[model samples]
Target: MNIRADIFSRLSRTDAHLFYLPPCPTPPFHSPPPQKRSPLHSRDKSKEKNVLITGTSLNGIGFESARVIAKHANLVIMTGHNSDRLNLAADTIKRELPSANIRPLILDLSSLDAVRKAAGEVNAFPEPLHVLIHNAAAPIGPFKLTVDNLESQVATDHICPFLFTKLVAPKILSARTEHYTPRVIFVSSIGHGIGTGVNFDTLGRPDPTRYVPMEAYYQAKSANVLTAIELSKRSKGQINAYSLHPGGIYTNIMNPASAPKEAVEGLHKLGLLEADGTPRKDATLKTMGQGAATTLVAAFDPRLDDKSGAYLNDCVAANELIGPPSSDPANAERLWNLTEQIIGETFTF
Candidate 1:
């Protein structure tokens, strides 16, 4: 199996019609992509730590990832725009892992100003932050610009997470007070390659080809991967960062509240996924929980401590960016620099 496919299952509605054992000659099923270097598989169970996960409200990747890490982490910080669900999730974790510390923060990530405020709060914590999980992302749906005038997807997925990770970096690195494995995992998606690669010039713009919502999401996700890679390289061993694609989980990814009603209805109508990994013998749809697994593995798995800067799928490291434009380490760096320019600051995270 291709290394990337092992880590992430790329199922697009565009391919839903092709998953079935169709009557026509089953068109060539191409071999999967290659895998990255496998880190030591055994997890270190001796240490207790803190992890911050974003965008986990209800049955999302953030919640699932929290469930996986609660046993190993001393504290888990969760953030989201949905206050009601955020409180509920925090309460559930507290009850489930009575010993684990769970803190909830409500912040709108679409605005860089709000992101800055959130970052400042994290920096003020008396203790160090060992892990920063940037899982929450707004899909490319409406042609909306954030309060910052940046595209919704780019601002939320790229700008907010990148800056937040930077703001928390010093605490994580300076915390020699404890044996810390500092990591930043940005949850990205395969749709990031909606059609092609990122357009450096039109990154935050609102236009036709430039404004295709899902296509924009691909750009932000790509930015996440690039930022993570650049950060890992910059910090050397001081900080570990990653861009991960949690496999297709059946989570209500594009919820009606968060996305268009038609978008959600169209996906249900497509019927391409299975929550349990029963390869959709009929179509390519995935269940919400199934989609959250890869993210959980990356955020909570101890085996990946030394393997920072990885892009993971399922429970393992995956290749660089997926889809058109292919994988290139140099391209990753280029995007990283371009992202920094967009936000007008170096990646201090």
Candidate 2:
């Protein structure tokens, strides 16, 4: 079926769909937020708000989210791992908007402990978090493991945001204008299909010899989408969570800056490109400003109210069943459980 038809089918059966779609071999195509709803709530519809963009130091989706949010919102907190890059990004934003309220913080999401701690600090920030954009992620690198021995992909992508959102939920909710609701947006990828289906039992297992880095990365991304849906169901009526595929881009996401030429060529064979290679929606190479467009729209767009569990691509919803079946059924709960166990006492619900 076509992309739109597939999404319609999935939407038709949302009550029965429980898990995210898993990995696949070929036939590339497509697939398919919100906060509280008040009676005729226009108070939350204003574009001006406080926003947080994660994983932007490397200048991909988060960086783009920052730029786009700046166009309508006044304050943005950019979080990443590298201090120099964080400062440069902040400076670049300042140079462009001059009046932008951009704060750069170096927070590595690789460690579950660190994510919990950082969430506490951010939740306490004076400014309300109207939009929390979770964008930072790393492919579970071959041969790398966290102190807790979990895969880096799950640690950064699933557990980290899980805890971060848990910690900041109330703060985001408080930002809701009388009629508006707070939102949490995740920059997911089409690559997430590689996770097979979420493995309920071995979510964080780490062993490079037994892993395909990209597929593992895809698993973590799927966890992201599932978790978002689960959160929407659990939040009762507070914060909303969403996962979106930001389309294809040729950013440093693959560590292309360090990869050998052959590796780059291999991806090119698969149709993924970088910088000059990205398809331009309007005459430019999908600027960081533009790459973040959907994120900003999802964050502040009034249309998304009560759609707290939506999975998106290019700003529209997607239906995963048209693509494939998820690898596991207990994945969402299992991943959420493992994440809570990792955060332990440090994590806040």
Best by lDDT: 1
Could you give the C-alpha RMSD of every candidate to the true structure, in order shown?
9.0, 9.5
What count of clashes does model 1 give? 18
Deviation (Å) of 40 in candidate 2: 24
* Candidate 2: segments with Cα more than 4 A from true spot: 1-46, 259-269, 273-290, 320-330, 345-349
**Reference-based lDDT, residue 318, model 2:** 60
Q: Taking the candidates one at a time, how many backbone clashes does each contain?
A: 18, 13
Q: Write the per-residue lDDT of candidate 1 for residues 96-208, one digit (tens) a residue.
A: 77887788887678877787788788888877887778888775466777787777877888777776776667877864344455777788776555557677777755565
Q: Candidate 2 lDDT, tens digit per residue, 103-165? A: 877677877677767777787788888888888887434646777687777778877777778
Q: TM-score per candidate, in order?
A: 0.76, 0.76
